[model samples]
Target: MTNLRIRAVEAGDLIPVDLPAPRPDVDGARWRRTRVAVADGQIVGIASVALSAATDSYFCEVEVVPGHRRRGIGTQLYAAVHRLTDPRFPVLARAMDSFPLRRRFAEALGCSVVTRCPAPWIDPPTPAAESWATGQQAPAGYRTTVIGDRPLAIVKDAWASSFAWVHRAFGAVHIDRIPQMWDQYSKGVDPAASAVAVDRNQTIVAFSLVSPDAWDGRTFIVAETAHPDQAHGTQVLGATVATSVTVLARRGTRRVQLEGHTTDRHTPDVMRSLPAVGSDPMDILRLEPPPAVSRGGCR
Candidate 1:
């Protein structure tokens, strides 16, 4: 503990520490502040806190290197991030359930689960499995196309509108933050494997966002969404997922992950309709404000 030092760093200066790089390309990434715990000139723990206009909350991420756990390093890193968080808005931390230590740390801070989701890994459709979705079609008057055919702005709006309910604790996503959010979520995405459903007016009403999992090249993440106003959203979503997953399997992706939260009505149904192997569940924890204290005065 004597040689431990915690200092601020720019996005470029971040040492991986096995955490996702909050790349600076996001438009609002400049507002994100990072801190690292260094001992003997080597980074062993990292923490970052950023205000997202899209979610209207302070988002935080913290990680300590394997050999450095059980020390107060994680607590110190988290303290740095909490100090940087704006108290006006709630703070949300995403800790994978697979890591009980991380989750326990968040719980110790009075954080409670806001949402629970199980991301399932499904085997790429074989010839027999392919037949079911292979013939699926978009809703009447809607045509299927690659997501790249549409402008990102349009896609962003459609995506936020459909998925905003899952993040209700944080509020709706602002239009300006879309680019940064997309850059973060769509890394290594397969353009051909991502599909969209456009109505006759050339408006995108539904989409399937497909990207290779960052940790596993053979595994892909598949996210599907459709506008709630669309009377046939279910059909559109099914068709889009069918189209995207087929192309992903054809491209040699071995496993596809379908993310579904208990709060989402559409995605859970869509995921259940598919042939999935197993799931990895996780929870999003939101820090609750401490109870106000009363002051006593001499009368």
Candidate 2:
């Protein structure tokens, strides 16, 4: 044994191990703090789950230091998280299409492969701009409304449900942790910059969360989307995309990009339905686990 101990992350204890910035929503829900594994008093692994308000859906993230591979730290940390969420609601973890190790770990925990959306980039469409100038109005009802704190919960539920369906169809486990999603979004994106669409009843039908990134040179990244479930799903999706493009253009963004798994044709169709939206291929992989009799259980 490596004498590793798993415990909650404390104030001033986070030292920027090997993962991206700490997600905001996960951190804010002080009750659902992150868990870190340490060996010899040095941080070696980390994992955390953000529990959702609706049902037992939680979003999770895990990271193991480069030097700590092959040890059971990753598994242990995940197991501990599972225990915390066990007998409650199902937990879902989101791994980047490029992170194979994490994906494999998820599978080992009895998670199935889910739907993949492609990450597509969009520049000011010159040809489309010309067409628009000729009176080709932006997609109908494709308007953008600011996302306020009041409507966040509803929007989050809608987003979680949509993603859960897509993942389930692909045979992947679904954990819709709302707090974690909110944390990641709040830290990485600007809420004021995000927008949602509403029907006549003022119900939020669709939305797009966007973040401005300077590293990619004034780029806008569509963090997520939730379209209505009614007959207007396609239209709602189109309006959300068009509204995002308009917002990014006004902010002086040179380009806009949305990242998702793109192996499926439906992914491309979803993007194409929106005016000026284009698709391109991106690399992604899912690693499998060794055959075993025991499958991890979801809360």
Q: Give the best candidate by TM-score.
A: 1
lDDT of 1 by residue, 1-299 (tens): 77999887654564754755543423344367777888887778888877776677877777888888778787778776777666777777776655777677776556767777777666665763376467667878988777665444456666666556555534665656655666666656666668878889887777777767655443545455544456676677778878877776676576677765666556777776776666667777776443310121111
lDDT of 2 at 217: 52
TM-score of 1: 0.80
Report the number of clashing residue pairs per model: 1, 19
Identify the candidate with maximal lDDT: 1
Which 10 consecutive residues of model 2 have the lowest summed lDDT? 284-293
Model 1 misplaced stretches (Cα beyond 4 Å): 10-30, 127-129, 148-154, 163-169, 183-188, 218-222, 288-299
Each candidate: what lDDT? 0.67, 0.55
Write the residue-wise lDDT of candidate 2 on 92-113 in tens digits: 6665445666666766665643
Where's the lowest-lDDT run of ten residues in candidate 1?
A: 290-299
Clash pairs (backbone) in predicted model 1: 54-174
